[model samples]
Every structure is written in C-alpha cells, then in structure tokens.
Target: MEQLICLEALSVILGVPIKPGSKGMSNVNELNVENLLFSTFFGNLFNGGPGKELFVDMNGFLDPQFDYDFRYCNDKSICKRGDEPYKRPCGWYRFALKVLNKYPDGNTWLGTDGWRSHSVAGEWPVSYHGTTIENAKKIVKSYYKPGDREKYGRGIYSTYDIDQAFDYSREFTSKNGKKYRVIMQNRINPKMRKVCKRQDYWLIEIPEGTSAAKEKEIVEKSFRPYGILMKQV
Candidate 1:
C-alpha cells in the first residue's frame, strides 16, 4: 500500500507527494504578481465572457458549450445527486475544452463517457485535477506542466472523483468579487496511467531524468486537458 497525503496542507505548501493505494488526498495555491495579472484575464473564463470564445468546436465555431438538461442528466454524476464517492458533477459548470482534438480523440466529451466504460481499450477515463490559480492559468495557456517529483514518482495528479479533486482546488475571487474554484477535467491516457487506489487517483508518470523536451512530449501523450469545470462558492 502507498502512503496518503493530507491535501489540506496544500493551502501553504505546493510540494505534493503521494503513493499508490493511499487512502487520503483528495487533491492547489497562491496569489502572486503574475497571478494578479492573470486573474484579471482569467475572469473571462468564468460563467461567461469574451475569453470563452477561444475554445472551438468540431465545426470550428466559438464556445462549444453543450446542451445539457439540469433537470435530469443521463449520467448521474452530473445530475447533482450525492450518490457516493463515484458520483458527482454537482455545482460545477463545465466549459468545453478540446485543445487539439486530433491525437487523443475519443468520445469522452462532456456528456458522453461513463465510469463503466473506463476499461474500454483506446478510451481514456475522466478525471479531475486541481491546481493553484497561477498554475491553472498557465496550464490553460501552455497545456503541460512537466510535473514534479514525488515520493512515488514524477507525474501529474488527478482523481476520478470531482469531490476529491475539489478538496485540492484553490478558490479565487473574480473581478466581480465572486469566489470560484477551478478544476481541470481530463481524459487520462489508459496506457500511461499509474493507478493510486483507495484515493482513486492516477499519477500519470513522466520518466525520471527525462530531458525537458522529452518530458514535454511524455506529459502531452500521457495527459489531455479536455474541459474546465468551475463552481461558484
């Protein structure tokens, strides 16, 4: 079994370390000059703003927001029901994301895939990744982090459960003084996943000692940020 990480401490420390089979960690952080500036722009991504027009659709149209019925969604996860550890899309609003729909192409889009299909070969499972305000902006802009070394290995952290990911998400105030939490909804590569059971996380590993360019390549092939899930607190 692997050691668990107390996610609450992430409020101050950003050096996160965890192991496989750990029970804890539901896993972001700070405000800085760059963040201050980025936050101003990041505000555009909230509920609605001109910035959202950036994400395109299969038809190359702006803002690929899907049509969803809040009344009763087919996927119970997003139906606002408190089913269990495996169910939840509650409170969060999803912004369409498909950075480059070519390579990691699949049907894991917003209302398409379910937990049962997680084992489908060539199909990645959905997961949520929490991060600091600055990193979230950087990730949305740059698309990869090269990850960091941890007790287990060098990889990006994400969970199948949104609530767990919510535990690690950092809250930021929009220009309007409204507070919100940001989470990256992703379809992790089944081939690259390193399952951390108990906590329901996948540490998508990048090889140790990898060159900068190589690391970039690995993280891209291993992870894909496909949607932005936001919730107002």
Candidate 2:
C-alpha cells in the first residue's frame, strides 16, 4: 500500500517479513511477492486482458536517480569481459508508474505503447524504457496522496481471483454492510498443505439446496461478457 509504514501489521497479516533488512534486493531474483500481488490485481481488474490505455511521458528525460550500471555481454560472446557494464535507467520506475496509475483518485488504466512514437528504435513502449527522472519521482510522490495508500487494503490487491471467487460463491452481505463471498474450495490451489488445509475453505456457512443448473446459469451470465463457457466444477 501507499504508506509502506505499519509494515509490522502487514507482515503479521501476510506472514511475510516485510521490514527493511529482512531481505535485500539481491534476494529478489525474479518477481517478488508484491509484484505478483500487483500482477494478480491487474489481471483480475482487467479480466485477463490489458484494458484501457495509460501513457507515461518519456520525452527526453532520463532520471539520474535511477541511473545505474547494468551488466551486458560484449560482442555477443559467452565470456565475461571488461566492457560488460553499461548505464541504464532503473527498471523499478515502471513499477512506480503502475502504483501511480492505480491511485484511487483516478481510474487505473493499463500502461500501453500509445505514448511511444513510430520512429523510436525500441520495440517496446518508451514507458518500458523509462521516463524522465523528475517524472518518476513525481509518480512515486503521488502515492502519498490522501486516500491513495489505503486503496490497496480495500481488497483490490487481493491475490485471489475476486471475480471468479465471487462467481463461484454466491455473494453475501454482512450485517455491517460488508460484501464477501464464501467460496467452497481453494480456487488458487486444490491440493492443500497439511498446515493450510484448515484455512482452505471459507468458514462461513453457505446456503444449501441451490440446484447446480441454477448456479451454472448465474456463472454463465457473469462470464458472458468475457466469452467464457461455464463448465462443471
């Protein structure tokens, strides 16, 4: 979320040590937990498609703050050499844009290649290449806006397939006006570890005696726009 403060609370809830010095950047060789979480959010929000368009202006600005030496193979050789280092913009700037775009103050759109020019040599969008360092900082600074940081806590950042989970489990509204689903199985993974089996299913009771045909009809209706076919679970 925005503040990145109260990480102790997050760590307790997520069962992951999120504090600084707990794990260095070196430990992250691939997509980290947060990135995967964001990816899940984006995947669900757009219904498995890149919906809408978001453009970050890259113009001629190169952020010095993100400037760093990156390793590259010289002469396409499989051997290491003295000329293997090159300066490039930080890749994390793209992640900053993702967070900025998800700001609750505005509708979040998928980042697109619309911002790039045809004359550019790069195949990917300039956003992938990066934007001006000033722009990058501004994007991250926007995360501090009031009501933005807490947006992630409103269930948008859940790794669960919210739409699918809601469809599978008839939604229920609680006395406190909170809407939730009582999914029967762990849609994320069927095989439950011995330690986690207890937490696999929603503990709340779901109404019984609903016909399978009726449930299928509801699922079909929900997935019609996405052109998905309902199959027996």
Best by TM-score: 1
Q: Write the per-residue lDDT of candidate 1 for residues 1-233, one digit (tens) a residue.
A: 00011111211122222112222323211111221222232332232332222221122211244412222334654321111133446666565442433343534333334334223334456778887777765665445564453645666777778778888788876544666677776766667778775557668777667788877677777666655565667
RMSD (Cα, Å) of candidate 1? 14.2
lDDT of each: 0.50, 0.22
Score every model by TM-score: 0.60, 0.18
* Model 2 residue 109 CA deviation in Å: 8.8
lDDT of 1 at 166: 84
Model 2, 1-233: lDDT tens digits are: 22132222222223233333223334331222232223242232233123322121211111223222222312321211111111122211111212322333332122222222122221111111112223222322221011122322210111122233333333333333443322111111111101123221111111245465653333222110100111111
State candidate 2's TM-score: 0.18
Q: Assess the local accuracy of residue 66 in candidate 2 as a C-alpha lDDT between 0 and 100.
A: 25
Clash number for candidate 1: 1
lDDT of 2: 0.22
